[model samples]
Target: MTIRVPVVERILSANDQLAVANRAQLDAAGVFSVNLMASPGAGKTSLITGTIQALQGELRIGAADGDLASSLDADRVAALGVPAVQINTGGTCHLDAAMFQGALSCLPLGQLDLLIVENVGNLVCPAAFQLGTHRSVLIASVPEGDDKPYKYPPMYRGVDALVLNKIDVLDAFDFDVDYFQRGVQALNPDLAFFPLSCKSGAGIEAWLEWLRAEVRAYKERRDVPGNSGTDH
Candidate 1:
C-alpha cells in the first residue's frame, strides 16, 4: 500500500520551465543576477556585507536574503542603505525561480546593476534549483573542510565561481589548499576560484574587480543599439 513517485526527470523539467521565465524577467530589466549558496556558518552574510560595502559608490547593488525563519541578514543589509529584500521560506529548504520572482517584485529592478540572492544555507538542496541567476557562486569555508567539493559534487558542479573563505584560519585547520583546488577542478575545471578572508578583508580586491567587470559587461550587452552613448 505504498504510493510510488515519478522519476527525477519530471521534477527537473518542471523546475527548468520556471527558470526560463525567471531569466526572461531579469533579462528585460538588464540586471545581472547571482545566486549564492553555502553551508551554515560559512560566512555567506559576512561575504555579502563585505561585497556591498566594497562595491558602494561603484555599482548599484541589490540583495535578497533567504532564510527559513529569520530576517536578521535582510535587516543588516537594509541598514547598509541598499535595496534589500527578505524572503522567508517557512519550512522550505531552498529557493526556486518562483520565490525569487516574488521577492524581486518589491525591489527596484531598474535601479540595480547587480542582484545577489543569498540562498538558504544548505549545500545539497539549494544547488538543485535555478532562480534565473546569470551565475551561481558557491562558498565553502575552511571550517567546512576542503573535501566539500568531492562530497557535495552536485553543488560544486552547478556553480560558476567558488569562494574558499576563511583563508586566515587555514593554518589553524588541517585543510590543504592544493588538494581542495584539485578536488574542485575535477568537477568544474574552469570554474573561477577565489580564496578570501572576510574577517581580515584579505584577497578581496580581485573578486571585487571581477564583479565590476561582470556588471559592466552585462550593462554593455543590454544597452540599446542606438543609445550606445548613454552611461549611468
Candidate 2:
C-alpha cells in the first residue's frame, strides 16, 4: 500500500501537468470547455443533444464523447450538425487530460465557441481527473435515487454543477429531491443545480441559460490580460 501511494501520486502529478497544457490550448483557441460526467444510463447523451439543440445557432458547439467502447455518443452529437470526436478508453473507467488532448487534436477548436467533453459514465473515477475544462458537471437521474449524493460524496463535491435528469419520471420514481439537495449542500454549498428532463424538455431553458452565462464568463475571463486560463 505504501509503495502504491507514491505511484498514484506520480500519475496524478503528470496528469495535472498535462491538464494545464490542455487548458492553455483551450484558452489560446478562445473556446469554453465543460467536463460532463455521470453514471451509465444517466441521460448524458440526451442532455448533450438537448444542449446542442438549444445553443445551435447562438454558439458553435463541439463534443468529445469518452466511452469504454463504441462511438454511438459521438454519432449522436454529429447527427445534430455538431463536430464530435470519440475517445474509446478501451475499458478505462475515466477520461484524463491525456485522452482529452488527443480528442482536441481531432476537433476544429478554432471554429468552436463551446466544447463539451462527455466523460465515461462513472460516478467516481471521472471526478478524480481534471480534463482542463472550465466547468465540471454531473448528471444524476431520478431512477438513480436521491441518495447518490450521500453515497458519492467525492463526485458531488468535485463538480461545479449538477443536472438532475429524467425529472419527468419523478412521479414514477422514489427520488427525494430535498434529501438530495441537503446532501449536496453539505458537500458544496454553492454548487449550481439544474433539475430537468431531457426526454420531455421540461426545465431545460434554465440549464441552457446557465450554460450561456458560463460561456460568456469564460470568454470575458479569457479576454483579460494575464489570465492563464486555469480552472477558476
Candidate 3:
C-alpha cells in the first residue's frame, strides 16, 4: 500500500525554507531586493528600465529577469550597463524560490545596492512563491482595467506595494482609478500605491522616490531592524 503525502505542502515548505536562507544571504550581502510581478504587457520591463536610468547614480543595481522564453527583457535592461541575469522559466508559470536561488548565485550581491527580480509575467503563480526579496511590487496597467484587484485578490493581498502603470492612457481607457484603488485598499489597507506612466513619465518621480526610500530603509533595517525592519 502507498501512503498519501501532501505534495503541495511539501513543495511550499521546501520553498519557504529556502526563501529564509535566500533572505538571509541578501541581508548578509547588504543587498535590498524587490520582486516585480505583473501580467504580460503591463510594462514591467519599461518600469525597470526607467528605474535603472533614474537611480543608476545613487544605486548600484542588478536584475534577474524571468520570461517563458528568450532573453528579450533581460537584454533590454542589460543594455543600460548593469549586471542582468536572464531566467527562462521554460513554460513554467512563475519563478519559484529554487529558480531564484540559481539566479542569485550568478549575481554579485555584495557589490550591488539593489536587485530587481522580474518574475514571469503572471498575476497568479508568482504570488504563491516567495523569492526571498526585501519586498514585492505588483504592476497593474490602466489598459488592464480596474477589476484586477477584485478578480486577483491573492495577487493584491500578497504584494507589499502596488503600481498602476500607464496613467497617460487613462484618458483613452475606461479605467476607474478610484475604483481600482478602492478594491486594492479593501484587500491591502496600508498598501503603497503609485499611479504612474512609463510612456510619458508623468508620475515616475513619485515611484522612484518610493524605491529610493525602500532601499534606504532596507539598509537601515539590516543594520538595525525596526518593527517593520524585517521585510527590508
Q: Best candidate per lDDT, number?
A: 2
The TM-score between candidate 1 and the true structure equals 0.92
Q: Looking at model 3, how many pairs of residues clash?
A: 0
Evaluate all candidate structures by whole-model CA lDDT and list the values in order. 0.86, 0.92, 0.91
The C-alpha stretches of model 2 lying farther than 4 A from their native spots are 228-231
Taking the tens digit of each residue's C-alpha lDDT, what string does model 1 give over 1-232? 1333456666767887888777777777777888999998798888889999999888888899999988899998988999999999999889987788898788998898789999999999998888878889999999988788889999999888989899999988989999999999999999888999999999988778878887887777667575422222
Error of 2 at 37 (Å): 0.5
lDDT of 3 by residue, 178-220 (tens): 9998999999998889999999999899899999999888777
Candidate 2 or 1, higher lDDT: 2
Compared with the true structure, what per-residue lDDT tens digits does model 2 show for residues 114-199? 99999999999998899888899999999999899899999999888999999998988978899999999999889889999999
Lowest lDDT 10-residue stretch of candidate 3 = 223-232
- Comparing 2 with 3 on TM-score, the higher-scoring candidate is 2
Clashes of each: 0, 0, 0
Pairs that collide, model 2: none
Where model 1 places Cα greater than 4 Å from the true spot, the runs are: 1-7, 224-232
- Using lDDT as the yardstick, the better of models 2 and 3 is 2
Clashing pairs in 1: none
Candidate 1, residue 22: lDDT: 74
